[model samples]
Target: GAGVSQSPRYKVAKRGQDVALRCDPISGHVSLFWYQQALGQGPEFLTYFQNEAQLDKSGLPSDRFFAERPEGSVSTLKIQRTQQEDSAVYLCASSVLRVNTEAFFGQGTRLTVV
Candidate 1:
């Protein structure tokens, strides 16, 4: 029963560079979601997937952000043309059952655009 984990818990990038962050969800979970939380703000849903099917992605801030869950398991979130405004904590969560269950969150991938 591996918990969700995100790498490079902290990242510093230039204003125009691209970056990719990784997320490892729990074993055998069916639903996965990504969120972005700005400083002192709530986590906003970025996207969601059930297995390999991406169910929702309405919260992605711009076209520069892309995410995928290729094998119905591990996922990656990529941001192109990083911006100072894009700095935030990217969070990943997963659940075993679909019914309003609490989503366990990693410490988060904190991105800082300089």
Candidate 2:
């Protein structure tokens, strides 16, 4: 796809289930980010990856949440032992530069844990 693409646009998981969300960023984009958007709130930064290196992950809520961009093109966010509070719209964005550049966002995967 020309823009960022996220798979399984919607997901429903039982409490304690594990889920993996995928993100495919635009070709050659160097900066990739993961954000978690709870209802009625703006997306909050979860992590940032420049190329294959994860430069920042301080925003991640807990160790149960994991994100990686192994080859730097495709990324994944995994939530383990899903809890109700973990439900949100997981957004993926990519930009050409590490800073001062507009990011292109995907439609996001909406996760609902019950």
Candidate 3:
């Protein structure tokens, strides 16, 4: 894909269930990021990766939330023990290695927790 790609555009999970979201970034893209967006709100950074190394994950809400870019190209986000408050749109973005570069976003995965 030329840009970021996310799977399972929509998902429904029962409360207390866990969910996993996948992201495939552009080939050779050195930077990848995960963001969470609540209804009517802007996306908030959740994690970042530089190649296979996770640079930062301070934005994750809890220890139950996890993200990884094992091979530097594909990333995954896992949410454990889902709650109604965890329902939101998860967005993935990728950009070049340099600073101030524009990021390309995927369509995002919308999770609705019942």
User: Which candidate leads in TM-score?
Assistant: 2
Better of 2 and 3 by TM-score: 2
Reference-based TM-score of each model: 0.95, 0.98, 0.96
Residue 95, model 3: lDDT of 89
Cα lDDT of model 3 by residue, 3-106, tens digit = 78999899999999999999999898899999999999999999999999999899999998999889889999999999999999999999886369989899
In model 1, which runs have C-alpha deviations exceeding 4 angstroms? none
The top-ranked prediction according to lDDT is 2
Q: Per model, state how many residue pairs clash.
A: 0, 0, 0
C-alpha lDDT of residue 24 in model 2? 96
Which candidate would rank higher by TM-score, 1 or 2? 2
Lowest summed-lDDT stretch of 10 residues in model 1?
A: 97-106
What tens-digit string does per-residue lDDT give for candidate 1 at 51-80?
A: 999989999999999999999989999999
**Sort order, TM-score high to low:** 2, 3, 1
lDDT of 1 at 7: 90
Question: Over the stretch 1-114, how does candidate 2's per-residue lDDT look in tens digits?
Answer: 688999889999999999999999999999999999999999999999999999999999999999988998999999999999998999999999978889999999999999
Better of 1 and 3 by TM-score: 3
